[model samples]
Target: MDYHIYLAGEIHSDWRDQLRASLKEKPGVHFHFYGPQENHDLSDAIGEHVLGEQPNAVYKDLQASKINNLRTELHLKKADLVIALFGEKFKQWNTATDAATAIALGKPTIVIRPESLHHPLKELSEKANVTVDTIEQAAQVIDYIFA
Candidate 1:
């Protein structure tokens, strides 16, 4: 059986690319990255706002739409487990929400935070089925548990 892992983390281009490449090495596991097709250079935001002006309602609506879409993709259908990757800082606004949704749905969840000592989503992370400090460790746990 194949395992579906929803990878959530910071949006920096290099970090994202590196993590994706690393996680893709896991055998029999599929990694899904949210918003991979979107432009990450703030171009999308700039295009949405003319002359640096965006309506608050428009922003809220777009965020809601994105969140709903993530829920549909990550929780309702695709993900067998959720993995939130963190670096030095734990900036997990949307990632935390997705993890919470996965837990609420009774699916397995894990957080891979290597550099963080105090995570903002500490409570939620602790409540997950398991938590590890690295993607490699997470992969090992997955293999052992799902083997």
Candidate 2:
């Protein structure tokens, strides 16, 4: 069976890339990721200009919001489990939202909090299926979930 895994985390560094590489080595698993820097084309350039011009316009327009929301919904539906990573930096709103979405959908969700433990995620972690402290621990949980 194909196992779809949704990854939620900060996008500033190469963590996603590293996780993707490691997870891809596992058999029968597919990783889905949506990041902040997805739109880098001409339209994205214009959209960035619009966002820069209007602080209230978070997504450039309604279409962007719809597209992102639809994408998130599709991924959530397809995902058998969700894994969220909280690095040394801190937790991000988007990552928390993704993890919460998985929880709301009744999917098994794992949250990784490495350094900062006393953040907003602590509240959510209480409700999550599992809260891990390292990527290795998260992987072991994933194995248990899918096994």
Candidate 3:
């Protein structure tokens, strides 16, 4: 069996790595995980690197967002499933967008947001195939779904 999972969410924490570590390789099963560039500086600078400097900081952000959106669109298309996490530290509108894109593409989506965020994310979770509070539970759902 083969699976292509797009790890979509706040990159502030090591949740992606933790989830990867939790899912031990099963015999005859292969997992391919993909996500936005984990390097914050690199992800932020990619725009200027490829497109040259923008007029100002906000313009720089616009350039970065364009490229980032391109990558996200392509990855979401290729993903068999998406695990979108909404963290506590910052607002993650992009995470919600990614999950929505995955759903639009007909890919299964699993959302992770704490109970504290439950109300805010209710609509998104309603659209997602599953919602969990922790990466551990997300992994368990993956195991069950793809086992």
In order, what lDDT does every prediction score? 0.61, 0.68, 0.90
After superposing candidate 3 on the true structure, give the runs of residues whose Cα lies further than 4 Å from its correct spot. none
Q: Which of the predicted structures, 1 or 3, would earn the higher lDDT when compared with the native?
A: 3
- Structure candidate 3, residue pairs in collision: none
By TM-score: ranked, best first: 3, 2, 1
Model 3 lDDT per residue over 1-147, tens place: 777899998888899999999886688889899988788898888889999988999988888989999999998998989999988998898888899989989999999889999999999999999999999999998888767
Off by over 4 Å in 1: 13-38, 41-76
| Residue-wise C-alpha lDDT for candidate 1, range 13-95, written one tens digit per residue | 35545555554355665555543223444434543443444468578457545644554454434677777666665465656
Q: Which one wins by lDDT: 1 or 2?
A: 2
What is candidate 3's CA lDDT for residue 108? 92
- Number of clashes found in candidate 3: 0
lDDT score, candidate 2, position 7: 75
Deviation (Å) of 73 in candidate 3: 0.8
Clashes of each: 0, 0, 0
Which 10-residue span in candidate 2 carries the lowest summed lDDT?
Answer: 35-44
Look at candidate 1 and give me any clashing residue pairs.
none
Q: What is the TM-score of each candidate against the true structure?
A: 0.64, 0.71, 0.95
